[model samples]
Target: MTFELLEKLENKINQAVETIALLQMEIEELKEDKANLAGKTEQLQSDNDRLNAEHQQWQERLSALVGKIEQAEENA
Candidate 1:
């Protein structure tokens, strides 16, 4: 092969290697982002569960208070 052709081939090979490296880095970054999102999702689910429990407790308290008020009204 001619010198010019060999030089061109080498340049193409170097470009391919650099592209591969960049793609690998991008893949790692995406993996990290996915893990972060999963953790955030878990935390949100936990928060939702806690809030639901608190809401149910408050509803029960409100219902009891209303019942007591109604009983008082009936006695009066």
Candidate 2:
């Protein structure tokens, strides 16, 4: 092969290698982001569950108070 042709091929190979390296770095970054998102999702789910329990408790307490109020009114 001509020296000029060989030089061109080498330059192309170098470019391809650089591109692959950059893509690998991006993949690593995306993986880290995915892990962070997963953790945040888990935390959000836990918070939602706790909030639901608290809401149910409040509902039960309010119902009990309403029942007492109704009974008092009837007695009066």
Candidate 3:
């Protein structure tokens, strides 16, 4: 092969290697992002569950209070 052809091949090989390196870095970044999102999702679900439990407790208390008030009025 001519010197010029060999130089072109070497340049192409170098470009391919650089492209591979960039792609690998991007994959690592994406993996990290996925892990972070998963953790956030778990936290949000836990918060929702806690809030639901509190709401249910309040609802039960309010229902009991209303029953007592109604009974008192009926007796009066």
Each candidate: what lDDT?
Answer: 0.99, 1.00, 0.99
**Tens digit per residue, CA lDDT, model 1, 1-76:** 6999999999999999999999999999999999999999999999999999999999999999999999999999
Q: What TM-scores do the predictions have?
A: 0.84, 0.91, 0.82
Best by TM-score: 2
After superposing candidate 1, which stretches have Cα over 4 Å from the reference?
Answer: none
Residue 41 lDDT in candidate 1: 100
Task: For model 1, give the 10-residue run with minimal summed lDDT.
Answer: 1-10
Q: How far is candidate 1 from the true structure (C-alpha RMSD, Å)?
A: 1.6
Task: Indicate whether candidate 1 or candidate 2 has the larger TM-score.
Answer: 2
Model 2 lDDT-worst window of ten: 1-10
TM-score of 2: 0.91
